[model samples]
Target: MKASKVLITGVSGFIGEALVFRLLVDKKFIPVAAARRATKFQGLCPVVSLDLNAPEAFPAFDDVSVVIHAAARVHVMNETASDALSEFRKVNVDGTLHLAKKAAESGVKRFIFISSIKVNGESTPPGKPFLADDVPAPMDPYGVSKREAEDALKQLGSETGMEVVIVRPPLVYGPGVKANFLSMLRWLSRGVPLPLGAIHNQRSLVALENLVDFIVTCINHPDAANETFLVSDGYDLSTTQLLRQLAAALGKKCRLLPIPQRCIIIVATLLKQKAVAQRICGSLQVDINKAHELLGWVPPVSIELAMRRTVDHYQDKQTK
Candidate 1:
């Protein structure tokens, strides 16, 4: 197959950086890496400056055939903005739709949007996981922005005949991971005894590699166009199971003390950290059956192996 001229936003982001390398190494995509700073992807791939907030500066899309959009105002905890939703909408909703509209007019063949499972809800009830077809009930500003973007993109696709593929992935963790995932790795690496042994909530996660693989699949698969997908590693693990598995992967002993879930939640609540509490005690899972049945896409990495790779990358970072 001929190499596609793929424009990848967020080239400096965690997932975006990983995608750039895969696109190069796989030799399937001639990635036009777009970022606010051209140096982000300098010397690695063809770099272009793209400020989503400034549509006037958006590079011409005449040669681009596919666009993998990964840029957005990601979720921030304890956000300091006075109007958080307004801040998010500026980049996530308005910025995304603007880019999609331009891509559609520029004759871009496909637009693959990276969305979040939080669009389904914060947590899932027992024995029921999030599906792509579920009505969105976003609980936070970030999720609301993504939900709105999806809707706008769907409408744009219908009106302009531009193929749109929406992918809602659960927590994505891997090498160079940051925020909560990185904090967890740091805590585990130092042998901190977490009081999360009693947590029985299952959370689905996708490996960075697995997610990029699926994106590539969507780039070419005919059935993937104009479809929404919920993707995971096809394995679910509770907090206890996750910590234990991560410990094993890091070649360390699991150190978790079984404190009651309510106790943990109460302490977190008193500390004004209900969101953190929910993450620890709540369940979040996504079903990838649609990706499997429709796109014939199975996660290329097993959870165990994925964890090992992630731990290895973390270890390498610590040593550096």
Candidate 2:
């Protein structure tokens, strides 16, 4: 079946950009990209400026058959709890509800929400990854807000009969990615000795391309309706392993020192950097078996390939 018009919020974001490109190239979905400002999108798509906080900022959805809600205030340290909660509610929850309501009124079919695995908490216990059915225990305000958004979307689904597909993804990185992960790559490329070599913490991460593939698949997948799915590259990595892999991708030797976890934690606490330490030393992993079984979806890109692509993108940007 041919897909009707699709609307995507946060088109200027990392995942949103990649998803928009994929939709334009592969699925050929009629793309409508929305952002707060005018910017250059890689490919041609009907771009619209919409401030999700305002009720009238949402565009007319009468022609939109599917809505991919990807816009969110997604910074870990830059935002206060109150600010983050309000922003998340405005964009992720309220904006989502607004779109869903319009879609239902306009006879739109699906609403795909890009949620975070942080909703399951900062870390999973030993020998167990977060399952799809686990009760949400978000550690920070961002996660809490995302959890609220998910609930709101589900409630909207129940109320309006619009199909809601919630995709909870972990750290998504690749070309054009930002945040601490990219910072680590830059540090590693400079041959800096990271003290996280001894910290054994497993974290799940998804590649941008892989995540975009899943989002595109979910757009029309019948099993996605009213279901929440955790997505990953299906590979878990420790801090040391991740650093080593990153170093390898950059063709640089891993200059890592085996630092004591206690010492690191103590220093971080004394320096009022507990959040940074938690991110580097936490064990957050997700089990994506449900996605595989339900949607018959699997990551087409390998971890090594994903990291390599990221390194290449960074290098090219540097040269430019």
Most accurate candidate by lDDT: 1
Query: Which numbered prediction scores highest in TM-score against the true structure?
Result: 1
Candidate 2 C-alpha lDDT tens digits along 9-100? 88888888777888778756888888888857634868877777776756677578888988887856767555667766776667767767
lDDT (0-100) at residue 219 of candidate 1? Answer: 91
Candidate lDDT values, in order:
0.90, 0.85
Runs of candidate 2 exceeding 4 Å displacement: 1-3, 80-84
Q: After TM-score superposition, what is the CA distance of residue 157 in candidate 1 from its true location, in Å?
A: 0.9
- Write one digit per residue (lDDT tens) for candidate 1, span 6-59: 999988898888888899898877998999985556787788889999997788
Question: Which stretches of model 1 miss by more than 4 angstroms?
Answer: none
Clashing pairs in 2: none
